[model samples]
Target chain A: GAGVSQSPSNKVTEKGKDVELRCDPISGHTALYWYRQSLGQGLEFLIYFQGNSAPDKSGLPSDRFSAERTGGSVSTLTIQRTQQEDSAVYLCASSLWAGSYNEQFFGPGTRLTVL
Target chain B: AQSVTQPDIHITVSEGASLELRCNYSYGATPYLFWYVQSPGQGLQLLLKYFSGDTLVQGIKGFEAEFKRSQSSFNLRKPSVHWSDAAEYFCAVALGDSNYQLIWGAGTKLIIKP
Candidate 1:
C-alpha cells in the first residue's frame, strides 16, 4: 500500500508570500496531522483532524497558519504572508484511527524556504 | 504541561557497538510511548511503541525499548548497531487513547563510525 504522500518536495518563496502545501493520507485513514520541524529541532505539533469532529487548531502557531482536510482524505496547509521564520520542513502524517494508539505514517515532507 | 525529554543532542559510536537512547516523559499517569527514526532525506518511521502489558517491546531493525513506569522513561537500545543505523531518533508521548496529538522530544542524532 502507498504510504502518506506530500506534494512539492521543495518550495522556495520570497517573504510576505503565501504558499499552500498538500498531503494525501492513506485510503482509509481517519486522522491527519501537520507538524513543523526546524533545523536540529523536534517536531512541533500544528493541527490535526479526527473523523467528523472539529479539527484541533490549538497547536497552530498563529492565525496566519491554517489547514483544512477535505473529504477526510487530503489535507492542505496554507501559510498567509509567510515570513523568513517560516522556513522549515512541513510534515504531514496519518494514522489508522484516532480513538486509540495507532502508529503514524509520515510523508516525505515539503521543505519550504522563504528568502 | 506535558513534555518529552531527550537529554543527548548527539552521540557518536563505532560500528558494532552497543547503543542506547534515553527518553523521559512528565505526566500524571502512564501514557502511550513511541520511538521514531528519520534517516537523511527520509520521512519519520515508527521504530516501536509501548502501550501496556509487557514492559519490553521489540521493534524493527533489531531495536527494542523498555518502558519504566517508576522512572517515567522509555529508553531505546540496540545490542549491535550497523553503520546504516545512523540517524535521528525521536521520543513522543500521547496523553490518552487519542494518538493524534503527541508531545515530541528534541531528538537525538546518532553518529556511527566504521
Candidate 2:
C-alpha cells in the first residue's frame, strides 16, 4: 500500500562535497529506477535494478554517480564530489516488474542544490 | 538513436477547452509509447500508453492517445481540460528490444487559464 519514498526533500551543500540520496521502493516491486530532473530539462535515467540481474548503469553520467540496491529493495544514489551542474531534483521510481508495460510509481523528489 | 520529442515547449488553454499535446518519437523499431503527467511538487503519473493493438487507446482521467506508425506520433488528447490539468507532460518511448530502456522527451508545460 505504501508508495515510493525518498529522503531529505531538500538538500544544499558546497561544491566538491559528496551526497547520498536514498529511495525506498514500494513493497513487492522488483524493479527500481533512479532518475535526475534538472531545471528546465527532462528526466534523465541513471541506474536500474531488476531482480538478481546486473544493474544497468549506462545512463549514469560519470563515475561520480553510483547507486546500489541492497537486499533487492532500497536503493541509494551517491554523488561523489558533487558539482553545481548536479543541482537538481533526484527522483526514484518502482514498478511491479522490470518491463515496458508496468507503470512506474514515483516518489516526491529530493531537490539538491550545490553551492 | 531512440528519442522522444514534445514539439511544443508550452501550451496554454482555457478551462473547459479542448486540449491536445503533440508527441513524436524516433526509434529503430516499433516502440512502446507512454504519456505521463506531473503536477508541481509531485511525482510523475501515467496518463496513458500505446503498445500495439488498436491505433487509438484510452486511459484514466478522461484522456486518450492515438498511435500512428506512419507519423511516428502518439498524441494525447482531452475533449475538455480542467484547471487542475495545469502541469508538465512528458512523452516517453521504451525500446522494444532494449530490455525496457526508456527515452524521455524534454516535457511540455501546460498553462490552464480560468
Candidate 3:
C-alpha cells in the first residue's frame, strides 16, 4: 500500500553541476518513469523503464539526462552538467506494468534548483 | 505526435457548485485518458481514467469523467465541489502502443470559493 517515494525533497545546485534524483517504486511494480515539471508548464516525460528491458530514452531531452532502474525496483535519474533551464520538479512514477491501461502512482518529487 | 489540451488555464467555482474541467486530446488511434490532481507541494493523484467499455468513469472523491469520442474529449466533472478541491488539474493521454508514455496538458488551476 506504500506509494512511490522520492529522495532529496529539494535540491539546489550550481549550473554545470550534476545531480542524481532517486525513486523507490512500490513493491512488485515493473514499470518506472521520470518526468520534469517546469513552472507554468506541463509534465515533460524523461525516461521510462520496464523490467529488465532497455529503458525508453526517447523523451530524454538530451544525452546529459540518463536514468537506471536497479533490480526492477528502484530508479535513479541523473542530470549531468545541469543548466538553468533544467530547474524544475523532478517527478517519478510507477505502475504495475508498462501499458496504456495501467495507472501510475506518483511520488512527491524532488525540486531541483539550478542557480 | 500525441498531445493533450486543457483550454482553461484557471477556473473558480463556489463550494457545493457543480464543476467541470475540459480536456481534449489528439492521437491517431483510440487513446487512454486520465485526470489527475496535484495540491501544492504534493504529488499527482489519479482522479479517474477512461480506457474502454462505458464512456463514463467514476473515481475517488466523488469525481467522474465522461469520454466523448466525437469531441475528442474526456472532461472531468463533480456534482458538488468542496473547498479542499482547490488544486491543479491535469489531463493526460497515454500512448496506445508499447511505449506507454503519457502526453500531458498545461493543467488547469481550480479555485474553490466560499
Compute fnat per model: 0.82, 0.61, 0.82
CA displacement after TM-score superposition, residue B10 of candidate 1 (Å): 0.7
Q: How well is candidate 3 docked (DockQ)?
A: 0.77
Among all candidates shown, the one with the greatest DockQ = 3
Candidate 3 residue A38 C-alpha distance from true site, Å: 1.0
lDDT of 1: 0.91
lDDT for each residue of candidate 2 in A1-115, tens digit (9 for 90 to 100): 4799998899999999999999999999999998999987778988789963546789999999988888888888999999999999999999988889788899999999999
What DockQ does each listed candidate score? 0.74, 0.66, 0.77
Clashing pairs in 3: none
Mark the regions of model 3 whose C-alpha exceeds 4 Å error after superposition.
Answer: none
lDDT of 2 by residue, B1-114 (tens): 777999999999999999999999987677988999999989899998888899899998999999989999999999999999999999998886346567889999999999
Tens-place lDDT per residue, model 3, B6-67, is 99999999999999999999987778888999999789999988778999999999999999
lDDT of 1 by residue, A4-86 (tens): 99999999999999999999998898888899999988899898888535457899999999888888788999999999999
List runs of model 1 lying over 4 Å from the truth. Answer: A52-54
Better of 2 and 3 by TM-score: 2
